[model samples]
Target: MAAKRPVDRPRPTLLIILAAALTLLTLQFRGLQPLDAFQQGVRDIVEPVRSLSDRLTDPVQTAWNGVFGFEALRLENERLEVELARMRGNALTSEADTELLNRLLSEVDIAYSDFDAVVVRILGQPPGNFSSHMIEVDKGTDDGIEEGMAVVTGAGLVGRLEQVDRSRSLVQLATHPDFRVGVRLVTSQDEGLAKGTGTEGILRIESGVRLDAQVDNDEVLVTSGGRSLFPGDIPVGKVLDPDSDADYRRSIIIGLAADLENLSFLKVVLPAEKPEGMR
Candidate 1:
């Protein structure tokens, strides 16, 4: 009578709770409206708290996603930047090619365009003003580019072949300090010599321009036929206003017709008997 009975465990309470959970799951699965209504009511009661909790956790989830995606995004940006630079380089190359094509087409209109020639690429050029100023061309005796032959572009005469090899030639640019060529004025028909003045890309006619000769700025000069290293009527340069003395005898300054610095492709004309013509 003194020993108490073992305390009864709440087995029925656990069984009741399990039964309720199973009943709720079965009713939800069976598409009963009452369970759904209860669910809705519960959701309505707790929705604000759920929303607040989600708001608090949303920034953390987004930060995790950004950290994981940043490397991929950076790689994609680098790829795009490389592609853009490549496109820009291609555009620049295309533009340069177009310019060369235009120059080749315009060469046909040069005064000595009828001369038999070879189209040669430049291999090298003088590095500075102090250098020999002789450019190397890809054509030589093999291509019939001989000594004293003219090297010209669409713009006009730029050089003459002096050092010839079997496969290549060295061209003495007209701007060279030792360069000299007989010249005749196009407008006045005054015969003169275009002599390099030892200055960079400058030529002067210190002797030929007569005091009485009517010469003005931008006067065209062509190679004089007789003893000139180049052919006659090959436009060499244009006169930029001359320097006059007391007797009005002038040292005519000539601006080179060809842009020597930009030579790419050029025509090496075989020397021929000088043609006679004047405007």
Candidate 2:
């Protein structure tokens, strides 16, 4: 009787209780189906850690996208910039060619057969006070550009060839202080010596010409060949204003018919001996 059945251990009941406690802990930790304060506390603590983890991984995702997207965007930007530059360059070149063509056509129409010449491009602007009104051209003595030869463009007379080298020439613009033209007003047919005064595109017409002369603004002035430095009948400039009493000669200010400030092309005329009959 004393050795009857081994005493049944309470282990099964303890295990059952332990398992229930563990299940309750797991539910609480997982915030599952429990609205208790303990569960809410667990959830609050874990929520911030999870949010931090997602934030930390965001940079990596961004970097991965950049590896593929960055090159495409960078290349596209470069291509667009290059294209824009090319288009601008093309437009500028087209404008320049158009100007040169017009100049050549005018030369032909004027029957300037005495000069064996082609259009030359202006390379750079001059550097001194005189340079502001003058330009350096791509022509030289080797190209038959002689000093004192007249330089003209499509719009009008630009200047006279000043300095000449074997490969280049300097043009003295009509606005230069030394520049003088024996010009006649188109409207009044009044003759005067037009001399540059070295101001903003202004010329002094000798006062001997009538002060009250009815020369309108933009009246065409042309070379009259009085002094013989320039050929006769070449377009010179347009009258900007009539002379005032304070101004010398009540001078008719002149605006150069050619855009001297922005010239790109020019034509040089070789000195031609005036025909006896024409003279």
State every prediction's TM-score relative to the real structure: 0.55, 0.52
**Which residue runs does candidate 1 get wrong by more than 4 Å?**
1-110, 126-130, 245-249, 273-279
lDDT of 2 at 84: 90
Candidate 2, pairs of clashing residues: 207-249, 243-250, 243-251
lDDT of 2 at 151: 86
Writing each residue's lDDT as its tens digit, candidate 2 over 122-186 gives 86664456476678777665675667778888666778887665556678877778887787665
Superposed Cα deviation of residue 231, candidate 1 (Å): 1.0
Clashes of 2: 3
Q: Where does candidate 1 clash, by residue pair? A: none
* Best candidate (score: TM-score): 1
lDDT per residue as tens, model 1, 92-149: 7868755653453344333466776789988665335645768877665656666787
- Candidate 2 lDDT for residue 5: 57
